[model samples]
Target chain A: MSGWTSVLVGDPRADRMVPKTGFTVQLTVFSSAAMAFLAVFALALSLATERLADRWSAELARTSTLRISAPQDQIAAQTEAALRVLQTTPGVGSARALSDDEQVALLEPWFGPDLPVASLPIPRLIEIVEIGDGFDATGLRARLQAEVPGAVLDDHTRWRAPLVAAADRLRSLGYISLALIGGAMAAMITLAAQAALSANSQVIRVMRLVGATDAFIAGAFVRRFTLRAFAGAGFGAAAGAAGIFFLPEADVAGGFLTGLGFEGLHWLWPLAIPPLAGTVAFVSTRTAAIRRLKEQS
Target chain B: MIELERVAYTYGGAELFADLSMTLAPGSFHFLTGPSGAGKTTLLKLCYGELIATSGMVRIFGQNTREMDRDQIALARRRIGVVHQDCQFLDHLPMAENVALPLTVSGRQEEADEYLADLLAWVGLSGQASQLPPQLSGGERQRAALARAVIMSPEVVIADEPTGNIDWEMSQRLLTLLVELNKMGKAVLIATHDLNLIRAAKTQVAARVLRLRGGQLQAAGSEL
Candidate 1:
């Protein structure tokens, strides 16, 4: 086109430090900016899932149950019998009936602090923690079913399986989202670069007439677009990182769902979004620029 | 050498020619003359590889135009130089850069520093090399265009309406330079409407005069 369009080297010599242009620089920048913003949430989601998984695994590792609900006169005797069985059982760490205060606290958020326990026949609650492979859940359940009648064993693995699987799926989904974002950034940058090239058709013809190769002409466009994308995404990422810093994170006693923000080593991961955006922009714009120039020839 | 066999070019459903043929040996000089809209510039473009013939064959240096890729066409173009009527240049660059463009594009910018300065001086615009194209007068621009065309020392030099925007004295000066290039073994093909300039060029060099009229090309009679 023109000398201005030829100033940027299309494909710089491998050993040379000269910068070259690629596919779609502006598109890359836009995609990077948008993706980087999304990537912050994905990364946070992944870290949160890992924590959720750990919490489920640790809390449910070795636990069983013994529920006792019988006739009002028989209730006291059955509770005592289940406690005696738990104390005598091998590998049992501890067995105790949950106190009224503990039960009230667990239900406080939903059912309020007060419960009409004397009017309604609420089943007695027991908590069991076991040591070293714990008591066999099936064996304990059979004994309680005969001796305590209303008693049931809960190893917690059934609920834990679904919870952990959901968390793991969320983590994988976050990674997939990050990949899609990167690809989208590349595609967007390429499109913007093509637009710029088309707009400068006269410049291209003049340059070609004067003997510049397609690579040289395309290089100029690629570099300009690449620089623009990198600079734009860098600004976007800085803003995103700053925004993440002020997000609300759940503290102690809150459910796993409330803790949806960055924690510990996870904070540093968001810092990499800017540079990753830049790399994607560079590659995408370069490819598009070269391809366009080749097609023009 | 350049050759055309029953060549024709069409644009926007308008026919410029149907059966035009011409040949130029090395070191030959020819003037293409026509009234306005006579396809003189179009014929010049065909002479170079800028526009391929719509039908028939146009060859440069014995290679068919159909066989040339962009790079091949560019390499072939390096052996030829073209000067447009408007003298297209990168307005952002100075006249020296403009004149040295052919060399620069050919990856021979290194040889331009001395040759370009000398060429600019020969064209009598040695003082204008550092100035931008827009800053130059019409006469000065024409001379710069001439310098740019010949800077590569190409085998063939094609000028389309080179002196159209300049005065008589300036036009004479440009013609003198073109004639000098012809003496240096460069085949010169100038497309113009000025018969007086053609008459003046014939005195300095043995030149052929061709006229494009009525969708056909013919050798002009020696009447001017």
Candidate 2:
């Protein structure tokens, strides 16, 4: 922090050599703010995808469902037999049959709330909770086949793998978006600094004539551009966070877009954007100033 | 405090001058007189380390300028004063700031206040301190440039055509200030084409006149 203050509080004597207000200043601030605003969405998307991957991996890996499709009189016996096989397995923690109302509610999104569970010839579903390493689905299926002949065990591997892969890919894209935003900000500030250096060529020559070091001349520009980026990014981060705050909450009706935001303590991440922008501005402007000065000299 | 030994300069496929040797010792006053395109300004630039000699050697304070980098040259310039022909300045700045620029660039802003008032008074520019460079007349701008040059109390003062744009009276006033600086034990080198200004300066100081012509530096023997 002290180092930051030292950079921010520059030598006023040298800084006064160049004019403070110009088109470059406005260009730097506006472009940095715009980039920071977009960065917020990228960050939200990344965090949301991460949460989705974790939920899918944890929920599907630790649980399985046993389905009994047999004759109406034989369905009760098959469900009991499947539950006995699951209880005897090494990794099985608890197994229970889902109630008709619970099963109907599971299908309610597609079939409506008034699903006729008793009249239809539907399979019975046994919810299996895994403890420790969880049961071996292949061995459990063989046991159920021999004992009840119509039961199947589903550990959700086939569906869970693809969903988790898609979520992971989306998270990577989010990170790539953030990198592009940072790169764009650096490039824009560098061009603006180059223009300012060209415009002040005479001033720089005079400064060199008067015994000003390259560091002294470059420091003025670096400090100004860095502060401008910091201020602009501060405003941008605040506005973006506020925009995210007003988004619709994630409910049963709402999907991924509604879930794309910070939750609880994750809200603090946006506060870092201003300093990050300032750092980017400092590096880019310093590089540009030094390179331009070398060419002029 | 500046030495040029057997120096030659060529530009645009033409040799401006060659085998030019001159030495400016402490408290010496010298005048460099030449016609237009005779490399008078170029010689002054070589004296101040602004231009490296194409051949031979130029040294400042006994250090060869050819061996010095830009940073070393800048540090050495703090000990020398240069007043350009056009009187260059940051036009956006006021006259006072322009005059005190040497101190400001050297990180001696605190020293500027103590010396600025007296320097401006001495140069007779105190009344025009708040005016911008564009607002000042030619003579006033030259005076401001001189003030900036001498604000550091350098060991050597080099001026290139300091009176080209001003009348005779203003030219004498500027000469008197340079003469005063010379009396304080500083080397003075002025490059100009005006013979009368050289005559005027000869009356006040024991000055040597050198002429650059036909690719050689020759001593002008009390002709004017």
Q: Report the error of model 1 at residue A156, Å.
A: 3.8
Whole-model lDDT, model 2: 0.90
Task: Compare the candidates by lDDT and give the number of the best one.
Answer: 2
User: Across residues B1-224, which tens digit of lDDT does each residue of candidate 1 receive?
Assistant: 99999998998899988899999878899999988998988898888888889998999999998788777777887788888899887666778887887776666768987697688889999898789889999999999988888888889999999999999999999999999999998899999989899999988999999999987989999695
Taking all chains together, each candidate's TM-score versus the true structure is 0.80, 0.95
Question: In every candidate, what fraction of the native interface contacts is reproduced?
Answer: 0.24, 0.68
Cα error, candidate 1, residue A183 (Å): 5.7
Candidate 2 Cα outliers beyond 4 Å, as residue runs: A1-6, A108-121
**What is the Cα-based lDDT of residue A53 in candidate 2?**
95
For residues B25-107, could you state the per-residue lDDT of candidate 2 as single tens digits? 99999999888889999999899888888999999999999999888889889989989889999988899998889898787
- TM-score between candidate 1 and the true structure: 0.80
